[model samples]
Target: MSRALKATAIRLTSASALAVTVLTAVGAAPASASTLTDGISATARAENGNGACAHGGYVGGPNQSSSCYGGTTTAHAWCADFAGWVWARNGVTGLSTLDDRAASFMDYGKKYGTISNTPHVGDAVVYNYNGSDYADHVALVTAVSGGTVTITGGNQGARPGHVSTNATSSYSVGSLPWGQRISGYVSPAGSNTPSLPNPASLPAGTLVKSPNGPDVKVIINGAGIPVAASDVTPDKYDLSKIVLVDDTAFRALPSAPASGTVVHDQAGGANRYVVIDGTALLIGAEDWTAAGYNDRADMGVPTAWLQNAAQRQLTTGIVVMDQTGKDPKRYVMVDGAALYISGSEWTADEYNTQTLMGVPGEWLKAAAKKVPSTGTVLMDQSGTDPSRYVMLNGAAVHISAAEWTANGYDKRSLMGVPGGWLASTVSAQVSNGTIVKDASGANATVYVMAGGVAVPLSYADFTGFGYDKRPLEGAPGEWLVSAAAKAAPADGTMLLSPDSNTVWQVVGGKKKAMTADQFGEGKLSFNDVVGVPTAFTAKFPTV
Candidate 1:
């Protein structure tokens, strides 16, 4: 609906969010990113229409020059070429050697460590729809809708090879079954802007001097951020917009940013100051901040606690967002039915304190114990501890731990299963083991192991599914047959009786009874069923 609502609902993905942020920035490119464009002026290039690239023209056989960008030829896929030309025309630096292949943008971004999922307004959207590690197409990120990124590209639709605004591709930001057709994003090549964020995102009582012509002023306050309250009037900017915090005792207001200048605070960490365009009053609570949580209004709606916080904070440990209550609490996330605890932040001292918070740590350990002791053991290569090793469409990738809490983080992608479902192998402790049948011969008892732990099957299910059962007065402990243990057992398995004389072996993938004559005295001592060996000839001495 509204632009502010849309922005608040979702965030722009990082074309380069992994790089550690600088304390002070005037919107300059990160150390890990090269400039692609400083944003286009459209000079004579209209936003859309037949004359999209009017001022630019083509000459020789469509080289990396400005001609190929808006050239009259559609000989090759020039999405990347047009993007490069746009960046070059806008006076961005460091892209003189940009290639025509759509994947080269990724190479440039990786070289500078800026290739990320977050897309800016002028980045190249790389795609891998064909399953290639290399991107198949490239487009420009022109807008972000909710959690979807919309971008424009070349060689698409009827206007082959023109800079068009409507040419778009979408990638999901904060959703499950997460991710877009997008491979990643590449920033523009150069131009060292001071890395300043929009001055409007600062807290109340922050004094800001508007940019005087093109001159910008950057000042780091004590908090390391360029935050201040103003009561100053100069050649430019209205000081009235600055929040006033007058002590009143001295009858004076706070000082203003020097020279009415737009400032970049060096105190704030990289990516520490994201623009929150929401209407709710969320404080920067430490736990919520670490978990990348949105603040709750002092007594605001509780469900509003961690909207879109699933991915980023999910990296390090188990992050359980107890969305069950009105105000959802946070907990460590775990696999196996998505176990979640209900609470806020925890520190190193409170580590392993699930019991303290009324969580059954023992229960989680049960599942974790079954998984590979270390995720590395499950990985093709384990260089270090990663955020999570995702198995997507059967392809496993190790996401970096450094970005455990970055935006667009989806766990099911890493888990390789749909939400609310877990990957598990239900195995009976004992297979092809001894079983006691009823006197009426209508039912059988299935023991879990050698020690006779009865197979714990749901009775309604045990009888409803037609496992061996009888019309007894009470449920029998002598489980002769398994109901749940062999729902869809693999071919060639064994089913035997506790008597040790009656033997049944799977033949040609079907269970067949062994002749009693075959297991008398010196006959075959063992019979194989479903890949398990059962001692049928040896008399099972009954107590």
Candidate 2:
């Protein structure tokens, strides 16, 4: 409840005679029981709606001058008079002048230990007059800074009806009325003990800032400095509910969370981020304060805004991706990390590579798939059909000599490992003795599947490519090579001719030589896609 209401309740509870008797008996009471807050509240209410205490017309001072104290005359100093009226309203009796009453009240507080001279919030700051007989100046301290009181007073001199900070002047008492000299302090009633907030009870990393409508800046642990009202989450926080996303790119206080701390996606309009640590996450923000800076948090006017906010560019660990991928584009990053680029702007290399440039559907499917513990695999470049030379783990699946191009390899449909396994048709002769090799005639493994099971390709299973005639050797489920069969092209028998380097052979009876465009668009057989924590095991060998 407000101080005025508390004082009113106190007055109502005691009988009029009893109150007078108590005051009379204890003419000099301690400042401990004094109500300085009550006095200030009463003064604010009186000055708010009525001209009785004309606030000195927005001159930036707390109260009006004495010249305008008596309901508009602007002659008498208004600070003491306002205090006098407040004192009277609080039922303080026998007070003719505000000046004398204020001093007497302070004197009574000092004599009885009811008040102190130190200034605090809601304290009546008494200023002494240099040449006057009595204490002539007073104001209500709304806030205190560096132990100096910012007062709301009136009727001292110029700017007579305004509120100002550290108002000390010639009219001030006990000392020269300068910015920070205090004559004496009057203890306001019920102010000695305040309900302090218990920090230990609050959650660690709790947002401890202003809890009211007016903007408030908070300093946490004397290190994490203030955050503005507009920047901070606009809400009141009690001791019970406070822990929230801290020092992350997306700034927010969550009512309920998935983790002890989960980041916000307010900027990207999507809830996804690469959490650097529990204390920080890389999220897209339209207005990020830490943009292009190391020390994100600071104590000063805020001037930061985010642009190009998105979640696809983030990783879970260290940031390594550059905005531009000129030559060295591919980045090996952790599943979750903050990725930064050299330029102010950058995009994923997968989105711009020449081999995978126009594959939007492939890109989406790859990204949307679950995270893979192992690396990614894409189809080789020379193969006409993506399913022809598939990528099992991170190596090429040697199907047949024709399945691979003469000079270039094929890897078009290689993005996501859906379901953990892939399948493709191979010529039966490939199971016989026939091997594919690099441009330098170096033998390369050719993977082949029989009985719907995958196997590694090795020279022991099939003869090296360009060999004339070989016989079949292994069973359908086992890795084996046979002797040379009829050396004729059949269904799905890919043949990479030594003549034209850039051509694919995919036909029933006749072979067709297709261009690069025709080669990349071929069909793919995605067997399965797997997320993390899944295993990939196979037991066949292809040579």
lDDT of 2: 0.32
Each model's TM-score? 0.26, 0.29
* TM-score for predicted model 2 compared with the true structure: 0.29
Tens digit per residue, CA lDDT, model 1, 1-543: 111211211111223222221111123353232222324323113334332234444211133543334344443555566566555544545664456666666656655555555666666666542222244456666655566555555544443335455423345322211122455666655553344344434443344443211112222221112222221222222445543221121111222321112121222221222212111112232323343333421111112111232112222233333221322433443333323322222333242453321112322233333322112112211212333443221122234443333322342234322111122211222222333233233444332222112333344434432344422211122222333334333433434544454455444434466676665467554533221123321222321
Candidate 1's C-alpha runs over 4 A off are: 1-38, 41-47, 50-53, 56-72, 129-134, 159-161, 167-169, 173-180, 192-543
List where candidate 2 sits over 4 angstroms from the true fold: 1-101, 104-123, 128-134, 140-152, 155-160, 167-173, 178-183, 192-260, 263-543
Best by TM-score: 2
Question: After TM-score superposition, what is the CA distance of residue 97 in candidate 1 from its true location, in Å?
Answer: 3.9
Over 209-285, each residue of candidate 2 has an lDDT whose tens digit, in order, gives 32211222232222222334444443233334433211211112221221112233322334322222222233334
For each of the candidates, the C-alpha root-mean-square deviation to the true structure, in angstroms, is 23.3, 23.9
Question: Least lDDT summed over 10 consecutive residues: which range in candidate 1?
Answer: 297-306
